[model samples]
Target: MPIEILMPALSPTMEEGTLAKWLVKEGDTVQSGDLLAEIETDKATMEFEAVDEGVIGKITVAEGTEGVKVNDVIAILLADGETADDIGGADAKPAPASSNAAPAEPSEATEPAAGYGRSGSAAQEDKPAAPAAGSKNGERIFASPLARRIAADKGLDLANITGSGPRGRIVKADVENVTAQPATAKAEAAAPAAKADAPKGSAMATGPSTDVILKTYEGRPFEEVKLDGMRKTVAARLTEAKQTVPHFYLRRDIQLDALMKFRSQLNTQLEARGVKLSVNDFIIKACALALQQVPEANAVWANDRTLRFEKSDVAVAVAIEGGLFTPVLKDAEMKSLSALSSEMKDLASRARDRKLAPHEYQGGSFAISNLGMFGIDNFDAIINPPHSAILAVGAGVKKPIVGKDGELSVGMVMSVTLSVDHRVIDGALGANLLAAIKDNLENPMTMLA
Candidate 1:
């Protein structure tokens, strides 16, 4: 039987994508790891690869096809003895419903290309026997290569683990979620708990339908624009954030006279090396160090618990054409100002081009959304989930300030708002975190120390 090549989910959030281009045509011979197609997910355009050696028997979906759901059979590959005739009589299998399964692990026969990011490994048991390629009933065990390896290493039986992948094919997540305990016992415990914890009904109200909105604006001169994948994902995630996440805002103003002066001197000295730094770079350093100063604030909200981190991974919001990307800077506190600036530039450039990999923009304990460059005064940012808080920075302007001697003086001041997730951080902790950020920014030279 010809192997079905389903549309791969490039990112965890991707539900559907554009089949941008097909690299191989029908009747073309493809070896394992050969480039198959370019899939444009909600985040970026990534190349999909072949997992098995075969000849391309058929192409089900056309190039430039939009809204092609994940797990939909995009193409078919015929093994050594098979040909295109095999596809016609093949029994069509059902696709899974919006699967969250991970990609197969790389093997000796083929190495995964540079762009696709793999998910992290979970807890596992001691080594077990490798599962057979076929099940007891003689049906082929349809599991990802990575899933099979994990199952074997963890001493798990493929027959015991139910797959949540396309056509009941076992993927990485299905294998990782299983524990060392007996499958029956785990399933029994999980079923009742799942039933007890299930929400009674949909608490979220649906917005007015499209027809209703269009009818309401009947006879109006307007163009109905279509929402792209990036825009759609942004809308859904931000809507979920506002509705479900408990957010509290804390605002503060900091004098930036000393910082600006210090920055000028550093830029002048570093001119030969072409290492000029932006105020945003300093802000990144300040927030990263602040997370260290007030360690309690450096955390994320896991479903049932809080995940505290040892290093400060900061996500910086970069606005692009259709939407935005928050490329994360891992271990930001340890990086020098010049290094942070360079990395931010590269990330922002790639983000605008939609070339960032999943890992480049995915995880972070905190995020910074600065509209200061846009000349905005101040605004509260919606917390990007799992993140404990986000710092919203605004423009700096000259303001009158009373000195310790009671004399009025003009100083460059900037307004900032820290939007904290109450689940991971409290009011006092957020305040302290903001205070630390302010202290670092105001006495900018101390950042060097």
Candidate 2:
């Protein structure tokens, strides 16, 4: 029998991605573990591998095609004993499977559209069977199994609900929206034509449209830069964070002379090992320790409840070309300053190249965004969820300060701003967490303890 090759979901949250390049063309002989294609998601570009050994019978989607939906048939594979004429069977169409199918892998023919790793036999045994095929007036409906269940329970017609998911496939969200409305209203709400008219992010509704903004620059000789997937995602997420998350900012200036001296001494001692420390490294250490010392504030907003973390997983924002990567250092509190520095250097390098995996750049209860190296004197940062707070670090500058004996002295002062999600952290708890961070950074030696 001929096999169908569906577009694989590279990450958990991915809906659609660009079929960046085809490593194998039609009629190419492919083996298990062979490189199949490269897929570019919003976060990174990942190479896809074939799980099946077969002759590539047909290539449906061409290279550089954007918004290729998951489970959409990308290619056709001819199994052994199967000729090219046999490839046109009904089996070539992708059968809708369970939403939680195992990650697809490269393999020999059978159960063709399953996730990345399982063989044909394992896929059939492990995967939940697709919904029984039936539809109104003999017209088949392309809706997820979960969506069908939800529509049944809500007494909503699948024909009325519209799908915003890949390839106009109805999903749970589309069905849920129809639960409270009449069939006519649901049809209106799900109309793709209506959605196409509205601009995203309330940008058009709240302010002037991009067309109006561009009108002002007309004949001014400006380059019209197109927004890449990363830039578009960043803009939407930041806008959502600011609008949805109730942010409260707390500013503090810490004396850095002691830390500066301590870092200088440590750097000299570690110079032979080729491990140079930066102020940002110290800041990361301080935040990690602070999360432990003030465990009450080490939490994240999980939409329904607060999630308190046991490990101080710290996400440090690394700026890339078009966007930024917040690569997490898992269990950061247990790691030494040297370890953090080394790991951070590697992460930043990979992040710049967009080689980081989804897990590497995701998850953390707290984040540290330091713009000090960029000469930014101190700016408030957006709370990157599900993180409860982010610490924004500024550059150190020499300033006069009052001494212990009531005398004036010159000291290096660095400013920091703590942006907290008011939903999870109150003002008092946030202040205490910031205070602990300040103490650790000021004393410098205590962080080692």
> Candidate 2 — which residues are off by over 4 angstroms?
89-206
Per-residue CA lDDT of model 2 for 192-263, tens digit only, reads: 435534544533345677899899888898887877677777876787788889999999999999999999
TM-score of each: 0.77, 0.79
| Model 2 C-alpha RMSD to native | 9.0
Off by over 4 Å in 1: 91-205
What Cα-based lDDT does every candidate model obtain? 0.80, 0.79
lDDT (tens digit, per residue) of candidate 1 on 384-446: 887989999999999999999999999999999999999889999999999999999999988
Kindly give the stretch of ten consecutive residues in candidate 1 with the minimal lDDT sum.
117-126
Best candidate, lDDT-wise? 1
Root-mean-square deviation of each candidate, in angstroms? 10.2, 9.0
